[model samples]
Target: MKHILLIPENEKPTLTAAIINTLLVSVLLIALFWISLNQIQMTLDFSFIGTYRIRLIKGFGMTVALGLIGFIISFFIGLLSALGQSCKILAVRYFCNLYVMLIRGTPLIMQIYLFFYILGTAWGIENRFVAGILILSLFEGAYIAEILRAGIQALDPEQMEAARAVGFTRKQTVRFVLLPQLIVLTVPSLTGQFASIIKDSSLLSMIAVIELTQTIREITATNFKLFEGYLFLGFLYLCLTLPITLLSKRLERRFRHEA
Candidate 1:
């Protein structure tokens, strides 16, 4: 008896479809963009890239600074919250659950207003940048906590056992073994949440924070160039988020290959 099977070089069905779809999408996007280019009104001074670009450049720097500080604080707080949720101590887990629920369930703009207006007002600290950063950090912390929690749970119990057997304390095991793997697994999710924070930073427009979106609106209002100013702001936002989105994809690919 003879039986034969032939497999294509790209044997995976998903991969083949993915390749075809990607090519189609690229062609379609190029065609669309070429057509759209003719319609874009550039009545504003295109030569004004330097002067008009300054606010966005500075705004992007401030936005990046905001993301960095907020992500750092949020991730740190998330780590502790994840640990609390995972702790054997019942009260710790209960309180941590409450913290996550409270933050995740609330409307972020309201939280930002209240935190900055009510709480911050009481302290006489009405700094928009500081207020924006803290509110975002608090909001993002909940989401990051859940991401880290899931990452930790995805690990094999044996990995923790192995670390424990290697004469490592609980702290050392988590620091050396768990945290590294958790970070690798959660990078994509964290990047998305980071982007969310940047987009949400637009809400700070309520308080007149001079971030990109707010500044652009102000410029457009003054110049009566709504579309142009907003188009510029939209580009600035793409600049902020596109790199992270691409980086996240690259990270996912690297980890997939490693795994």
Candidate 2:
């Protein structure tokens, strides 16, 4: 014999504070969107269009060049450092760790000022872009090293043992098996590193390198159009960052698919 129990067909759940807060946030965003569109329409003037376009194009190109070169240098430094830290030699590991720690501890902007302004042209290194790249490379190199190390270390110990067992020498294992695999796994981290390099390029403005942020600041100062300048800059930054974000997502998907 079984006892039958009857309950309400649809039980209503009580609204929590979190739910209320989410609704409030949605409403606030809707209102902010409406306000921003009105202001954007009023402020987006293309007066002095040719000059402004030239300034922006030149600045954007410089920014991209700096970021790309820095990414390459940083990636190289990071790989070497990551490998050195993971090396069997005690001296190699210790020195690599020390370098990583020192670089990570310092502020990137300070590094830029030190390299570009203090160590100027007469010191046989006057080019602002060159100094900017070196500093950015060193700054982001520390972080990218950690990412590479993690990606390498994330490989299974069994896989390494299997490589060794299969008559692969240590060097052969690293080159043929470990490095190729690490490069694939490190794609997301490298994308993040690239994005960081791009944003950090803004610090070059302090040394008057005329990157995108510097151009925007200069333009806003003359036009007294701070709001519009910032809005445009935000859009530019988004444009720069969004591709890296998509690439990272795509790489993640590919990795998952391969797995």
RMSD of 1: 5.7
lDDT of 1 by residue, 164-234 (tens): 89999989997998877777888888888888778877887777778777777777776776756776777
**What count of clashes does model 1 give?**
0
Model 1 stretches astray by more than 4 angstroms = 1-49, 88-92, 166-172, 257-259
Q: Tell how far residue 244 is off in model 2, in angstroms.
A: 1.1
C-alpha lDDT of all candidate models, in order:
0.80, 0.83
Question: What is the overall TM-score of model 1 with all chains considered together?
Answer: 0.79
Best-fitting candidate, scored by lDDT: 2
TM-score of each: 0.79, 0.79
Worst 10 residues of 1 by lDDT: 1-10
Worst 10 residues of 2 by lDDT: 1-10
